[model samples]
Target: MVSVVGFLFATQARMPDHLRFAFRILTLVFDAWPYATTGKPFHRLDLPRRIDQVERWKRSRLAFRQGLIAFYRSFVIFGLYSELSKQDADRGMRAKQD
Candidate 1:
């Protein structure tokens, strides 16, 4: 989540102020959405509930909601793979040195 937010901000650095603000507001909404069902913010939810909430968003009928989740999902996956790749590269370098 932190990586996703950082990636978002970094990518949006040159975007118009209004769009940047809208993204920030949307991030808050995403964090708050789980509260309706579990009375807890998204980040504070347990793993199972967090997965459930994301599934709900992915299956939402509203196109905007679907798109929003898709956008975040892409970033999350990218961040995960990026970190993994970085670790792998670091390990390879260490092995070469040894």
Candidate 2:
């Protein structure tokens, strides 16, 4: 399902360095807690509860990988866009000078 994939994606870099998640703190929360609430004590989650955690771990990992790929690709695209803009501005400046 979509959520499963999403969960795996989130788990990828949910730990150290926090690759590129929604937010730093959000990723930190994921890293700090990869399990579910057991409805018991504040910090109590049964072993089975960890199943969701495992799925999330997998989700995060996949998402992180995809994010890295997307990020690198975007840099290329953005770089091209930036270069074009810069060239356009330079052209205008040159025109004014002429």
Highest TM-score against the true fold, candidate? 1
TM-score between model 2 and native: 0.34
lDDT of each: 0.81, 0.52
- Local error of candidate 2 at residue 4 (angstroms): 35
Kindly list the per-residue Cα lDDT of model 1 for residues 1-98, writing each as its tens digit: 34756876576675689867877787789899988878999999999988887898889998766877887788778877888888899999999999
Off by over 4 Å in 1: 1-5, 12-18
* Window of ten residues with lowest summed lDDT in model 1: 1-10
Best by lDDT: 1
Off by over 4 Å in 2: 1-16, 20-65
TM-scores for all predictions: 0.74, 0.34
